[model samples]
Target: MTLNRRQAIAATAALFAAARAATPRGAFAQSPTTPEVRKAVLGYIALTDAAPLIIAKEKGIFAKYGLPDVEVSKQASWGATRDNIVLGGERGGIDGAHILSPLPYLIHTGRVTQNNQPVPMVLLARLNTNGQAISVAEKHKPLGARLDASPLRRAMNRESKFAMTFRGGTHDLWIRYWLAAGGIDPDGDVQTIVVPPPQMVANMKVNTMDAFCVGEPWNDQLVNQRIGYSALVTGELWRDHPEKALGMRADWVERHPRATEALTAAVIEAQRWCDADANKPEMCSIIGRRAWFNVPVPDILPRSQGNIDYGDGRRVENFPLRMKFWRDHASYPFPSHDLWFLTEDIRWGVLPSNTDAKALIAQVNREGIWRAAAERAGVPASEMPSGPSRGRETFFDGKVFDPEDPAAYLASLTIKKLAGA
Candidate 1:
């Protein structure tokens, strides 16, 4: 109490030091306004589902959330995205990507990685839902394959090549589901090939593929070019089905938890912006830029606006179930949705039949991170989901997948490539 000026200063400094010591180290780094790193390299394929990441970058949403130097680079294919994510940003690759929801699980389990090496990854958020399509070449247009693949079953054989982006990705799952619903065996009766999203229209033009399942604007482009007709938009198969997701290297996320939240928040905001009906034209124009998809607005806007010209003498204007980015809780990374992907992968022999889906989902899904980021993005509490599961989901073919009992759903399927079958 009677200390001199120097003594008082020393006592104050000591008190401050003690306070800092008492505070947890993570508390200081977890501030939403400050990130450990300002730059993060994120990859995206030239697909409409990637619109959120592109919008986040172009609209300065990332800068709004303390990440200004973030790079939204276009990846060539899902395979390339996987490879780059494995390389990470420091090695001239990416820290994250607009990826298939199942890809992170596959990579995390080393099922899709090189030499069976697991590259741990985190599912931060779902980029969008219900915008992908299964297209059939003009040659098969006469077969009249709509929601039912039975029409095309006559045309399918081992030589019939169907294309998807990656081995266990969403496209593969969708096409497989469609064929199976119509009693067409995807593995035994037809061949499924891998083709990049941007190359889909070109491949169809040359008859390189009999059909393909991919995200826009390829499906719309195929119709516009008269190369093929859409057998069905994936939404028709399963309305509001989860598609692309925002996934990151777990190491990068662990190294920069604050940055991870900021990145996710930015994307969430961009998703809201992208979902607005009024922003359709502007959003399409931005994504169609030469620096991005290099696609014309005509090719990208129709289906995105819920308008579709099936090219098989069927056109639906203002279709109710189209692409959803933020509305209907589209951006939430639901653990139940991830479980569906893992379960389907197992059904197709992509993941082992014995895989513990719930445990694996717990390991790879970052729904907690998504909730935090959603709050950071100023999402109103009312807009947030009350629970992780969306309850039981019903597909167009009348197959119901109850998240509570995936075993029953799997066992119900008549056609499957389960392990050792």
Candidate 2:
């Protein structure tokens, strides 16, 4: 009963092994695949949804699956993440990144980088879904600001600027969708600029931006700091909307297929762990460490636990559709979602009207790789959806986006900066 540290560790390991053996097949046991390379450097931003990668690195899931040297380092900003990932692991940056869902497509298509030279990146898995928000500064609340941009529109002038992490990224799209739905043209009605997520609250404090759309802690932090109010949660826009992704260079994935599989399996395991309500408190504590998010546990834990304080006299004690790391097939990179991102980029004139969306999705989405990793992890086949599409997704506005008819979806949009429009 009074064993030394080593003996206690051994006993715990034995128990873990026994549990894995007794569990149903595909319940996230260690995979048989051995990685070709042991060392990998990955990138993350300071957001709660970065949980899967952080959990993988912290929980020794990487080492359990033969990727002991996987490093999950924090990046200064999403732009830095893009640039460093482009630099690759050999150049002292990163091999891959926990990236914005649309970023892999943007990188592959040469939209976000210098010289417009495409980077052939492959999406390994989606990291999380939902749990992002658009917050309006306190100044706009006096103008009766709410989810609908109507009051905010009355207060807007040419000088009003909105902030999002990246111009063509997820936050941008969310804010644009929200504003456009409320009869505000994100492009023509106001100026929009880029501000990193961590700096969103700081920027709002200085009156640099009227509003911003970003991932957790920052939006929650703003409400804590008394500078802004949450206008809407992104999940309310579209439940279980795909958010971040785990992406690596196509060359890297090609050179080390086994390594990629190992990495995916480890991350999938981590996602499942993070999604468990029981593990949320520990997950928050770990990610809140200064080396990771550099935010307090108080700020981080509330949102992770689905306790949202909108900081505008509105609160949801048990908000449905909070950040999901694994549930609802969140890890699977649905090609249909990829198509939606592409079409939205085209709608905003970020991609050409003539771009072949289907061909590009095939080139970038590595769903097959994800499936292989799932099988290796012993994920039951029943959990995996039968097709590449999640089918028609309906949004808060009651608009349906049929992946099969993205062109029709695009044509139906009232506010668009479509190419040649």
Q: Each model's TM-score, in the order given? A: 0.93, 0.91
How many steric overlaps are in each model, in order? Answer: 0, 2
Top lDDT prediction, candidate number? 1
TM-score, structure 1 vs. true: 0.93
Please give the CA lDDT of all the candidate structures: 0.93, 0.90
Candidate 2: list runs displaced more than 4 Å. Answer: 1-32
Deviation from native of the Cα of residue 386 in model 1, angstroms: 0.4
Candidate 2 residue-wise lDDT, 81-107, digit = tens: 999988999998899999999998888
Q: Least accurate stretch of 10 residues (summed lDDT) in model 2?
A: 25-34
Positional deviation of residue 228's Cα in model 2 after best superposition, in angstroms: 0.7
